[model samples]
Target: MGVGVFGRNHARVYQELERQGEAVRLVGVVDSDLDRADAVAREFGCRAFGSIEQMLTTHSEVRAASVAAPTVHHLEVARALMQKGVDVLIEKPLAASLAEADELVQLAATHKRIAQAGHLERFNPAVRATIPLLTQPMFFEVHRLSVFTPRSLDVDVVLDLMIHDLDIVLSFANSPVKEVRAVGLPILSGKVDIANVRLEFESGCVANFTASRVSTERVRKLRFFQPQQYVSVDYGRQEVLVFTVGGDGATSGAPTVNPQIKVAKPTVTSEEPLHAELKSFLQAVRQRSTPVVPLEDGRRSLALALDIVAAIREHGKKVGLAGLAKAKS
Candidate 1:
């Protein structure tokens, strides 16, 4: 409902869908700030409202809406929408706390509303192609870094950035986390700006993740090793590369770099992830089915992110960072 950075993208995609002949319409834009709402609505050629109630009242034809408010307000906004029979796509990190996440999950169920979580990476073409190739991922190494921006400083690097990789790794691992070890520092923001985490899963899978918002360059890539093969995914490029070990039995599919190694790249139908995500959400809404990324999935990812944050805090305390942050603040 809010027309901030990410919210504007949602509105843009909806408007694009209308122009592309999709059975969808961008009814209106809503924000607590009336001026911002009016600006975005004027840009999109739609009406503007100062609150969800106003938008819902003015645009009764809106069957679905995106809850793009900040994390703390997710439950409040989504709950209001679901209660009024409007399906919602809530932005990631689901909520500021697990209790709030659980409440939204229950509320969605209670209202029988089609609720989805905005885990945009799940819609990436590379990730979609790699899903079927998964056999048994043993280890993962992921890096997501970006130059510092004032936006989303409400959350640490783990929630703001690494949660995308966390959701992917969790899906691939398909097991509960057994242990978490993490370390992070506040370089540019009060929240952790750079973090490194190691997660051990019950299935004996290990994942190491590094996320930074204070970087000189931008990077978004993930590489994982499994039995007899290794797979690499480039989120920015929307590509997947598979390196397989060849046995003496066969080698007819891909080019062989050596007698025992074959490298293959899966064909990726490149599309903007956010566009694909919103399209998928609409499809789910029309079909009355579960979305590719559901509320439970968001909650699971949030749980892991919160645990990693807790680990970071505990580690920081052991090293006197708690006092350091307090003193600085």
Candidate 2:
């Protein structure tokens, strides 16, 4: 709805879909900033509105819409749309708080709306390919780092960056979290800019996640081990490599273990995750079915991220980081 950075991309993709003869259409763009909205509308060849109410009032044909506004405005925007009988695709970290997330879930149910969560990584080909190979995952090591960016500093790294991995791991573990240990620091922002988290699941699965917005390099990768097998996924590369034990692993051309290990790469059709996500959302809208990533899934990830944030706070308090934070500020 809001034509900010991410919202603009959403508009662009919707426009692309229209050009491709999809059953969807990009009716208009909405932003509180008139100039920004007008600019995006001009770029996408659509009308601009100052608010969601204005858009809905003018364009009643908009059966579905995307809520790409900031995290804080998710509930208000999505609720307004759902109230007006429009399905919506809300951006990640479903809401700022669990109560708001619950409100969204209830609103969707009450309105009979097809609500989708914009967990972009779920559509990543690498992640999709790694799904079927899942077993009793015992351990995980994940790293997501990026150079310092001023965007998304409104939230901590746990929500802004690490939540993607959190959702994926939670789905893989398929068990309740037993314990959480986390520590983070505000490197270049008031909120936690870098974090390390350890999660233990009830099924004896342990996962370690490290996320940073202040880093020298950019890396997005997840590796896990289960039952004498290890799988690695590179989100950026859209690639997956699996290592299986007790096989003819002597093939030296691929990513493999020793002679006793076998390496295989699942077939992954590379495509931009955002495009895939939007296409899937539109398909769900047309079919009147559930989305791949629903509001409940988003809430699950949000709850875990919130827990890690709480753990970070507890660790900070124990280490006397409050004074350090105050002094730094």
Candidate 3:
């Protein structure tokens, strides 16, 4: 219901889906800034409203919506929609805090609403392609970097970027987190702009994550090791590469430098992740089924992200970063 950068993209995709005859319509766009909302609605040929209440009052037929509002207003916006019998696809990080996330889960249950978490990576073709290759993932090295932008500065790097990988790894490991160690620093904003985290799962799996919003180059890649396979997923390129050990190289047919290693690039059907995510959300709303990425999974990721943020704060206090910065300033 927000017409900001991410919300605008949602609106555009909805319009695209309608053009492609998806049995959906872009009824309207909402934003605190009326000008922004008006612009987006004009571009998508829909109505514009200044508030969720205004839009809901004007259009009672909006059975489902994408809540791209700021993290802080997630509960407020989603509550208004859900209470009115509208399904929702809430953007990532779910809510600003764990309490809010829990409340969202409860609200969905109480209202019997079809709700989905907006973890775009879960819909990425590369990630989907890598799902079948999962087998005792023991270690992971993931990186998500982007050039500095003023957008999404309201939250730390953990929520802004790392949470995506957190969701993925949490699903892959399928075990409780045993330990969390994290360090972060504010580079371009008051909130953390870069962070590195180490997580150990109860299943004896470990994952290292580095996320930065300030970078010279953009990179979105995840590499992991399983029992006999190492899989690499490039989110930006929408590709999956698998390397199997001591297996006949029948998948790729390309001669490997090591005869013992066989490489296979899984076929990934290219589609905009947002397109797939929204389509799934609509299907869930229509059939009253569980969304692929549900509120529970979102809450799980948010819980871990909050723990990492707390760890980062603890490390900063231990190293006297606050005092050092005060002295420098």
TM-scores, all models, native as reference: 0.95, 0.94, 0.94
- How high is the lDDT of residue 38 in model 2? 99
lDDT of 2 by residue, 41-136 (tens): 999999999998899889988899899899999999999999999999999989999999999999999999999999999999999999999988
For residues 1-329, write the lDDT of model 3, one tens digit per residue: 99898999999999999999998989999999999999999998999999888988899888999999889999999999999999999999999989999999999999999999999999999999988889899999999999998988878899989999999999989999999999888887878888899999999999999999999999999999986778999999999999878745534666556658778998899999999999999899889999999999999999999899888888887897663233110
lDDT of 1 at 34: 92
lDDT tens digits, residues 56-166, model 1?
888887899999988889989998899999999999989999999999999989999999999999999999999999999999999999999898987889999999999
How far residue 282's Cα lies from its native spot in candidate 2, in Å, is 0.9
Off by over 4 Å in 2: 247-259, 323-329
TM-score-based ranking, best first? Answer: 1, 2, 3
Candidate 2 clash total?
Answer: 0
